[model samples]
Target: MSSAKVWTIAETSGRRLKPVSYELPARGRMLADKLGTRLASVVIGDQVDRNDLQELFWRGVDEIYLVTHPELAGFLVENYSNVLIALIKTYRPEIIIAAATTTGRTLMPHVAVRLPAGLTADCTELDIEEETGNLLQTRPAIGGNILATIKTPHHRPQMATVRPKSTKPLPRDESRSGLIHIVKFNPNWIDGRVKKVGMRQIEETGAGIQDTDVVIAGGKGLKKGENFSLLRELAMLLGGVVGASREAVDRGWISYPHQVGLSGKTVTPKLYLAAGISGAIQHLAGMKTAEVIVAVNSDPEAPIFKVADFGIVGDLFTVLPAFISRLKGGKAK
Candidate 1:
C-alpha cells in the first residue's frame, strides 16, 4: 500500500524560481520518507519555466507537477487557488508546504477553507512524529520566548505555509533525476472573482534577506538611520542585502520591510552578519537558521552570542567600517 504523498508548492518572482522554492525539496524528502511516501512539487503559472526545473531533479524530488495556463501567467489569487485545490483533490497529497509569502499567505487560506483542512502558518521547522506519523510543526511563539510544536491531529492533507529561509534546499546532484507531469489547466475552471487589472509595485521587506546567500543586518547600535549607510555599503561589497533589527525599524533607523525578528522576515542565508544587535528572542526566531551567524556587539554577554557561530565583543561603529574596508579591498583585487 502506498503511503501518503508529500508535495511542495513552488513560487516564482520576476519569472524566476524563488530561493525558498528550491530549498523545500530538502525538507520534503525528509517528511516524505518519514511517512514512507514519495516527494513531489507543484509549479503553477501562466507560462511555466520549463528549463529551470532541472535543478529540482537534482534535489531529489520524485516528480514535478507542472500546471500552466494563460490565466495563471499573472497571479490571480482566485485562479491560483482554484488550480491548487484541483491538484490537491486529484492527487490527494497528505501534506502540502508553501512559502509564507504574500501570495501563499493569501492563497493557502482560500484552498484550506475549500478543503476544510487544517493549515498552519509561519512554521520555522517541520518534522514527522515517529510514533503516529503526524507532521510536527515547530515555530516561535509568545513573543518568541517559547518554541511551539503543533500538529493537525485529525486533518488530512495537512498544510503549512513556512517562513522563507527556514530550511536549506537540498544540494543539487546531477546524478539524481525525476519526471515532470504536466497538468492540463483550463481557464474556465475558476469563478474569476478576482482580477489582475493593473500592476503596481509597492515595497515589501527583505528582498535580499529572503533569497540571498548573505545578509548584513543592523540594530539600534547603528545609532541612527544614517548609520545604516555603512551596512548598505558593506552589503554592496558583499553582494548581500541589508536587514534591520526591530529596534532599528522602530527607531526609524530603517524601514519595517528590513526588520528581522519574530514580527519581521525570517531569513535563511549562508551567512548572517549582525552588528549592534543585542539578540532578542523575537529577533533570533527570525534568523536562527542561518548556516553561519556572526554577531558583533560591544557587550560580550549579549544574548545573540548564544546562537552565533562567531562573536566579536566590540563597538559596531568601529567594527563595521573596518569590515567594509576589508571587503572593499578584497573586491578591488
Candidate 2:
C-alpha cells in the first residue's frame, strides 16, 4: 500500500523548545498519512535526552534514529551534515522534512549539497501524490503571492524545511509507543573546526509572545513611535505580549523581531487584539490562525475588521486608555 518511507529531523534544548522541531514531525506525519506509509524520525546530538524522542513516538513515528557523538552536541554544521548525509545514504527515505529554524535551515543546505537532493525551504504544506507517490512540497514564492509545488523525480528522498507554527503538531498519545535505534557514530572524518565554546539560554520576558493567551498587536495606524506606548500600556494591563505588523517595522515604529507577517513570526494566540492596522495580506498570513481576532481601527472599512470577531470603529488613542483604566479598576475590585 505504501511506496516510500517518511522521515523527520528531531532536535531539543531547554524546555523553551525550538518552534520548528515540533513542526517538522507534524509535517512528516501529514505526508506519511497521505502516502499510507511509515513515518521515521532521526535525531542528532551527543546529550540528546530521549524525552523528546519518546514524545515523537506518539506523533506517528514508526522508528526513531539517534546519531549520537560527543562532537555533535549543539548543532555544529559539519557534524550534523555528516550524520544526516550518512542516514540519507543508508536508510534512503522517500521524504525528509526539516524545520526551517536556524539550525534546520543551516544544516539542510549542507545535507542537500552532499546528497544531491532537491530541497525546498520554508515550505508551508507537504503531501504525497496519490497516483505517483511523489512528494509534493508547496511554498510561497515571489513575495508570498505564488504558491510553488516542487517535486524530486530522480532523487530518492524529497527534502523540505517548513516554517515554524505553520502546521498543527500531531496529537500526542502517551499510550502509543515506537522503537528507538541508537546509531553508533564515530568522529573520525570531521575536523574539529569549531569547539563547543559556551552555551546560554535567552530568557523569555514579559509573557512570551508565543505563549500569551492575549496579544495586543499594534500597526502603523498609531502614526508615530511614541504612540506604541499606548499599546504597551494596554498590553501590560492585560498581562499580554505586543505584536506588530510588518508596516510598523518598516516605518521604524517597532523592531523586526516583533513584526508579525509572512516574513516574520506566525502567532496563534487565544485572543488577538489588533489596533491601528489596515491588515495587509502578508500580515493576515501570520495571525489568521488566532482563536479570536478583535480589531480596533478608526476606519470601519479596514481590512483587519473583515477577519476580526469583534470590530471597533474608533481611534485606538482614545480607546486604549479607557480600556486600560477599566481593566485596572476591575483588578482593584
Number of the top-ranking candidate, with lDDT as the measure: 1
**lDDT for each residue of candidate 1 in 1-333, tens digit (9 for 90 to 100):** 223399988887546666777878888899998888888888887565666677877887888888876667766788888888888888888899988888788989999999898888878789998999889998767755678888998887899888676677787888987888888877666667767678645363355567677899999788889988898898888888999899999998888778898888888778999999999888998888788999999999999999999999999988888887877788563
Candidate 2 clashes: the total is: 0
Query: In model 2, which regions exceed 4 Å deviation?
Result: 1-4, 14-20, 189-191, 194-215, 223-240, 250-253, 262-272, 280-293, 301-310, 321-333
Name the lDDT value of residue 327 in candidate 1. Answer: 75
For candidate 2, write residues 118-228 as lDDT tens digits.
899877668777789898888777655678998888887788887655566788888878777778886663658877788654332422565466778999889988898
Q: Pick the candidate with the highest TM-score.
A: 1
Q: Which stretches of candidate 1 lie over 4 Å from their true place?
A: 1-4, 197-205, 299-307, 331-333
| Cα-based lDDT at residue 216, candidate 1 | 94
Worst 10 residues of 1 by lDDT: 199-208
What's each prediction's TM-score?
0.86, 0.79
Per-model tally of clashing residue pairs: 4, 0
